[model samples]
Target: MTETQRKVGFLICLITIVLAVLDLQIVSAATVPIVRDLDPDHGVDKIPWLVSAFALASAAMLPLYGKLCDTLGAKRVFTGAIATFLLGSALCGAAQSMEQLIAARAVQGLGGGGLMSVTMVVIAHLKGPDEEGTGKGGSAGGLVAGAGMAVGPWIGGLLADHASWRWIFYVNLPIGLAVLAASAFVLKLPDHPVRRPLDYLGAALGAAFSSALLLVTDWGGNRYAWSSPVVVGLIVTAAAALALFLWRQTRAAEPILPLSLFRVRELRLGFVIQAIVGAAMMCAIYYVLVYLQIARGVASSSAGLYLLPMAIGMSTAGLLSGRLTARGWSARTFTLSGTATTALAFGLLALTTGPATSLWLIRAALLLMGLGLGQLMGQLILLVQFAAPRHQLGVATTGIRFFQTLGGALGASVFGSVLARLYAADGPGGDVSALARLTGTAHAEGVRAFVSATDVVFWSGAALMTLATVLAVRLPRPGRPEDTEQPARQPEPVPA
Candidate 1:
């Protein structure tokens, strides 16, 4: 690829990130209409699954996607992934039942998961040349990549507001076509085909553990009450599956998630930090939506709009942190500082009374939290990649994301439940009639409950973030977010 084409290829991938990451938050704004259309009888309480299920799928499938990326070429896998995403989006638009919607979402999640992780690996491969303008350690490349992803929620909101919420998913169609076209002509990726075989056993075990664990978590409190037979059975089954997964991964020749990567202190610590960070962030967005639309009577579009500050705050923080890391600051500094800042931010947020409570205060709180989270992903990603042998970067990168995926799923589910619990008694005299008339009828009680419960959940998220800060301090700085050491041998084989 010529210089111009490389730039264009890079731009195409940026568009891919926008389409992919938007899957996570797109439902945040669209769930209202989705629930009305899919399960009018269930109301808002049960509708979170519409949003949370996709998150769970994307989270659960991240490693699956990563492992496949290693086995498959990035271009092949990327094209396939986007195709699946577009198919899922169309299916979601036509979904007629809750079951159908959930299944369609899983399909989207499968592709979304691939899009999330491969973009990084692909950028690494595409930007291998250290041309004069490519910048240090591909930092410019990484920055473009990360920044493209960070803006997903904001773009998602914009689409949901101006177009129908369904357009959020639909928009990916044209973009995916454009990416495919660009890749065919512009993107020049070095093929690194390794001799390692795909570890199907490992994939199956990982799937068992991830899917079952999340299923139990999602169904435990809501589907069957805590002690229901179904819940108990799921929990017991998940424990057994996870145990088997651990045992098999130890012996697999090419494990989907080689546990050996954790031997590196920085890598292991980074993985833990990623999980904690995911949990904290997952909860923050979940509760903030609650506070804005439910507790305070803000419009749906306005609620999505409020989160714009958070995206901006994180963008600024992400860029600054990358620059700071380049200047020789340690990961420990940014990670720990971010966590501390997040704690302060969330603590302040927990004190806010309502959406109208104070715009500046909310902005400040989100700003701090975003700043902390901004540098998080790219920084630790470098650590994990650095710790791995080149040939193993595929599995290793996926492994880090697996931990993050699991944490995010658990975080979102637990937080949603917490929000529900916090507002169980929210209605006036336990009567939702007026609220039913006031809010969307089918969603009246649930919406009110989530709103009333937002404060408590936000406080809980705040506490979780505080814990993340402590974990962040334990890892040594990996140096720069972009300056990762190459594996002794490259992970992708050189093209002939």
Candidate 2:
């Protein structure tokens, strides 16, 4: 492919990624309005699923999507994913019930699972097999994703407040159609003619395990008590499924997730850090919006504006870290510092934020948090990519994403449960929206309760980040003699 084709292909992939990442943040901001409009009677109780279902479905499909990209060719799989997502978006926009909306979101996630991973694969194909190409492509991708995340909430809030909440989903139609057109006419990706047999059993086992695990998180204390038969059964099922999946990996000719990837110390440690980051980051983003809206009585659109500082911090730090890593800065240095900085930011948030706190102070904390997170986001991918063998690069990359998504799913469910329990105990028994909308003394009580509950949630986030900091310290330094040394002879390039 020529330089121009590569550029167009990269642009197309980047736009698709932006769309995928943006979907989560935008939907999160719009959740309040959506619930109010669709299920005002029991909307608060169902709010978590609006996010969790998408995350769960996306996590479940990730490993299989990676395998499919290799077997079906990136172009074919990517096109299909876009189509699936578009169909889901239309359904989401038209849905009149919470159950229908949640199911549609799952379909959207099934498509979204492919968008991020396949884009990375396609970018790799465009850049060929070179370290410089990997660094540049990875850096660009991270920046675009961060930017998308930063703006998504604001866009969602604006649409939800001024237009209809449905517009958040409806907005995807035109952008997706344009991507499809460009992908067909302008994007040129290499095709692999050889087909590998897919590990259907492994995929099934992996999906079962993830679904059961998410159910345990989602329903354990909310839908049923932790000791209830349903919760216990789900937990047992998840454990059993995990055991089977691991066992199958040992014998399958091509496992859906290659168990051997965990043998690499850097990749292994990097995944742990990535998972922690994913959990902490998701909690911070979504819960902060909750605090602003419920506790501080900020408008939804304005709540999104508050995230700008964090977004700026993340985008700036992410780009700088990527450039520095390419210039020989150690990944371990950024990992340790970034995780520590994030922990400190969360610590500040836990201690400082209250109903009476200044919005500017909260924004300042978010900015610091974003700076730390941005450094980790780009560097971790590079660390894993460098550590992975050439043949396993695609799987290794997708594996990092898989764990991260899983972490997000778990975090959202757990945090949502905590918030619900605390809020229920502190306020009158009803939806948080009703509590927030009360007048005079009742309004004050609602605000206090919301603030108190949010404080607990932020504390949990800080604790998670602190654990991530500890794990980040254990990561091996990048570019060490042992880390850099490779076989003198290069392997033949695999067909893309």
Candidate 3:
């Protein structure tokens, strides 16, 4: 690949990353408008499915997407993912009812699963033959992702308020078409000459397990009681599927996710730390928004703006980390320092946050949280890529993303349950939702209870980060002989 092709491919991948991250967040600001226009009477009750459909479908396809990348090559897989996503986007824009939109979103998610992970794989391949690691590519991707997370809701709000909610889905079409066209022309990825059989049964079982587990997490104690038959049955199903998937992996000709990757110290530690960081990030971003709305009396739209400070911090840290990486900073050094900084940030939030806590102080904590998170986000992927065997690069890259997403889902459920239980024990009502209806003394007491519960959540985040920091301490020193660099494979030419 020439330098011009590399630059164009990188740009396309970055745009795809932004689209993937933005779509996940943008719907939040338009839910009310969506319900009003689609099914004014019953759509409100079905709104959660809009988000769940996309996430469930996305998670279910991850392992398969990675396997396809390795077998069929990244160029073919990447373009196909984009085409599928754009088709879903068009269907979403044309949908006449909430159900149609939900189905369309699921279709979009099938493609969306590959957009981020496979793009990273492509970026890895974009490196010059003599170039080492991902260089600045990972950092650039992380910075864009952070910015997208920060601005997605605002952009959704602007579209929903000024024009139409449908524009949110429609907006992807032109940009996606441009990305698709550019990628087809510019991405020069190698095709695998040897076609490998995919582990269809293993992939199916893995998808079943992830789908069942996600449903359990999303519905437990929210949509159903913890003791409800639905949640219990789902949990059992997930466990059984997971067991079967693991059993199949040991025997499959080409497993979707190779269990042998776990043997590497860096890959093992990197996955664990990434998951914990993903969970902790939920506490920082989600709960902070919750606190602002309920306790500080800030509007939802205004509360989202608070994330801008964190985004700025992420950009700053990512920039610095990239430069330092070039200057000879090891991945282990970044992981250790990043985890420690994140733990301190969460601890500060736990210790100082209250109903009357200053916004400036909260912003400072968020900024610190971002600084730490920035270092870990990109570096962990690079770490896993470097440590993994050459043949399993695709699975290893996606595995980090898979664990982080799973952790975030589990964390949100657990933290939400904690907040509700604590609020029920101390506040006027068993339901925290009642706080919105409370006034005077009741509201004040509810706010106090809420703040106390949130502190516990932040403290739990601190403990998790502390554990990640300890794990980071055990990473093998850089330049170990075991860390063998894989030679670049020869390419099969892509057809125009």
Highest lDDT model number: 3
Off by over 4 Å in 2: 31-49, 94-100, 128-134, 416-456, 483-496
What lDDT is obtained when candidate 1 is compared to the true structure?
A: 0.66
- If ranked by lDDT, best first, what sequence of candidates would result? 3, 2, 1
Better of 2 and 3 by TM-score: 3
1 versus 3: better TM-score goes to:
3
What's the TM-score of every candidate structure? 0.82, 0.87, 0.96
Instruction: Write down the TM-score for model 3.
Output: 0.96
What lDDT tens digits, residue by residue, belong to model 3 across residues 312-429? Answer: 8887887787678767787678888889999999998987789887889998998998888878877888788767776788898888888887888888889989998999999887
Q: RMSD for each model, in Å, please?
A: 5.2, 3.6, 2.9
Query: Per-residue CA lDDT of candidate 2, range 166-245, in tens?
Result: 98898889999999998898766656587788999999999899989888887887779889999999999999999999
The best candidate by TM-score is 3
Q: How far in Å is the alpha carbon of 117 misplaced in model 3?
A: 0.8
lDDT of 1 by residue, 7-118 (tens): 7766776677767666776676566666676678875775757766676677666666677767766777777878888889888877778788778888888788777677
lDDT against the true structure, each candidate: 0.66, 0.80, 0.86
TM-score of 2: 0.87
List ranges where model 3 is wrong by over 4 Å: 482-496
